[model samples]
Target: MKRINEQKGFTLTEILIVLVVAGILLSLILPNVLQAIERGNVTAHQSNLNTINVALFMCYTQERDWTQCADITDLTDGNFLEEVPENPFGGGYDIEDSPDVAAGDINAGKVACSTVEVTVGGDTLPGTCSGA
Candidate 1:
């Protein structure tokens, strides 16, 4: 008498196919996930810029002139800011006295600060700032 055998597991070819499909799906999904994360980073950087701008404006209001805040770190006034906001891309902010642009010109109205040029994963994107 002969006994019948039952199939209880996937074959090697079937397993390979599943793996390839999973890999393809992951490849398609990973870029979008990464892009979303990058966008979030950019948003955070923008928020930081806004915070700094507000603080600078407050400082100007109190002083009646633009403060020579050379960098974000120079903002030590507790009422203004605890410290300088760092560049989300990994560098410090670049503060300068703008005497040309409206609302940013130190001599005209306000002091303007900008982010240092940053590169993300070899791609150069515009940084978060008033002009940028």
Candidate 2:
């Protein structure tokens, strides 16, 4: 009687097929991962803005006035916040004075007294009041 040997491992074709499937799966997942990271950055910017707003409100309550704190440096100097929050996209905060608008104006809704307009990546999130 003669004995025959059986296959012990995967063939080369099977290994190549597995590699191709893995590559396809990675291609589908990579973009979504990158997009999530970008969105996380945006969320961080928004959270920073909200923190500044709270600090400004606290300052206003103590000072009893709606006045800009000289600048971002002043906010840090007065200990409202540990330091000025930087825009996640890039650059520092874009400080702007509010225009004189009546109690009810279309633009008024987008403007806050003594506001600090934070421009991230050239896109402005309006009505961020730093003093009021």
Candidate 3:
């Protein structure tokens, strides 16, 4: 009589158990990973806002006012900034001068010239350079 060798492999129940365990582990870890990504976006958005603040302040130093500029492109065009940094969260930066101050005034109605507002993740996260 010839002896037969039994080939060992993962049974269906064992495979199912492994898959279930894997799914459980993934479910536990995925939320943390998503949270980390969101936090990263917030940090990046804040940093971008701060960078915009610096550029805007530099523009103020040169022009003595913040009224002439309305957007990030103005900073680049005026050479106050080398390049406009992109918003990390997907929203664009808008320069909001003090509405009370008329255009061409020294203050140009700028209550806060060096502050930049940023909204990220479809406005899920909103922040300012001052806050950052």
User: Which candidate number maximizes TM-score?
Assistant: 3
lDDT of each: 0.66, 0.68, 0.69
Best by lDDT: 3
| TM-score per candidate | 0.65, 0.64, 0.73
Comparing 2 with 3 on TM-score, the higher-scoring candidate is: 3
Candidate 2 lDDT (Cα, 0 to 1): 0.68
Best-to-worst ranking by lDDT = 3, 2, 1
User: TM-score of the candidate numbered 1?
Assistant: 0.65
Candidate 2 residue pairs that clash: none
**What would the per-residue lDDT of candidate 2 be over residues 4-52, giving only the tens digit for each residue?**
8766899999999999999999999999999998999889888987877
Models, CA RMSD each: 5.3, 6.3, 4.2
Query: Judged by lDDT relative to the true structure, which candidate is superior, 1 or 3?
Result: 3
**Per-residue CA lDDT of candidate 3, range 1-132, in tens?**
866997779999999999999999999999999999989977886787677777877887887766656677888899867877777667576676545445554365533433333445556333344411
